[model samples]
Target: MTREASPAQRTRALIIDAAADLLAASASGEFSTREVCDAAGVTAPTLYHHFGDKDGLLREVAADRFSRYLTRKQALETTGDPVEDFRRGWDMHVEFGVANPALYNIMYGRRIEGRTTPADHAHAVLVTMMRDLERAGRLRMPTGTAADMVASAAVGVTLHLIRTRAAADDHLSALVRDAVTAAVISPPTVPGAASVTPQLARAAAQLEAEMPHGSVGTLRASEATLLREWLTQLSVLGRMAGGAPS
Candidate 1:
């Protein structure tokens, strides 16, 4: 059964919707609190009560709208192959930016100190995918590093596409995606010629992923902490060695 939103929830939604409408119609991507309050049919104090201030209100509006894109990303069905799933994620990111230029600009362009954004949630999802690759011995660097590389490159490509209005240039996105992917992911290992550095890194990553789950067996807390330090060092060495083909 579906439950109706409470009155406060409805009011908050009203303010957010009003702000989004104004932002979309805005030429400078800026809207005054007065404008939002008028559009929402709420008093200034009421607006402040709900969202702290103007920046807070804008952040909420961007997060609320960007959540739709994040929903689709979270709902994406993964293939057995993590690399293919990663590629699909990249494509979806670009498509979302191209389809919603105004929302995309505000979502990615603005930065608020000490505040988390929907984009951070998306990066978390990417990090999880990179972990899958690490477990499969396909990742060449630490999972966080690989995820950061992919996120940075994907955003750059998406923004370029949005700024130039070159949504038709699909090849450019694919090229950048593949380039970043190749840099961070290792080729499949042959029968007996597996690269030692990647193998060590993969083993370390798998252990690191499992450690937090109390999967370290009989190791004491102190012992586990020391082991994690060692694993981190190995992972760094693997990254420094680069992603040579196996």
Candidate 2:
């Protein structure tokens, strides 16, 4: 059986839920602390006691709502193929962004320094997926670089869709996803004559990914750290050689 929340927990939850409702209903996708307090049937002091400030309240609300969204996202089963999983992940991200514009904006649109959100979990999932692709010899770039490219493009397209309130057919999320995949994933090569550069990049990326699994072979922790740093540089060398930033 589920345990009941304490009175304090209950009150905090009430405040967060009220703020989320206000944020969702507001034209600007924001709400004042006074508004949230009033909506929650609490005074400013009570709200501040629980959340410290308006920003804290909003951050909590965003984290709560994003966590719920992630719960649903995590429910989707993986298909074993990393590429297909990434396609589904991209689709889910765009769909969630479009469906929950206010929350999406709060979760991803705001840029704050030194503050992490529940959204970081989503990015972590992407990085792990990229690592899987690297291990499979299908990645064409460093895992971090590929994650950045895919995330930037996906978020940019989703934000455009949100701003324009584009119709289903007009949304170019799939096209953008496909373009990113083509740019970062190696196409299946024939039996012979595969390019060496992508092979090198993939090997470097795979090694970097494996480093986190702990000391490789007989390497000490310090040695593994240095090796990872070198692999990171090597992973991006091919792109640098081709005039892209390392």
Give the TM-score of each candidate.
Answer: 0.73, 0.73
Q: What does candidate 2 score on TM?
A: 0.73
**Candidate 2 whole-model C-alpha lDDT, 0 to 1:** 0.77
Output the TM-score of candidate 1: 0.73
What is the per-residue lDDT of model 1 for residues 1-246, given as tens digits with 9 covering 90 to 100?
Answer: 889999999999999999999878876677799999899999999999999988788778878988877887778677877668778878988998887777777778777644787788778878988898999888868998998999899889988997887873478998888767666776654443433478878788777767768657787655666677666556655665674223
Give the alpha carbon lDDT tens digit for every residue of 1-246 in model 2.
Answer: 989999999999999999989887887896788888888899999999998877778778878887887889889888976668778888888888887788888768985333577667678877988898898877867999998888899888888998999843354777778767666676443344322376687777787777766658997655665566566656556444542322
Top model by lDDT, which number? 1
List per-prediction Cα lDDT, in the order shown.
0.79, 0.77
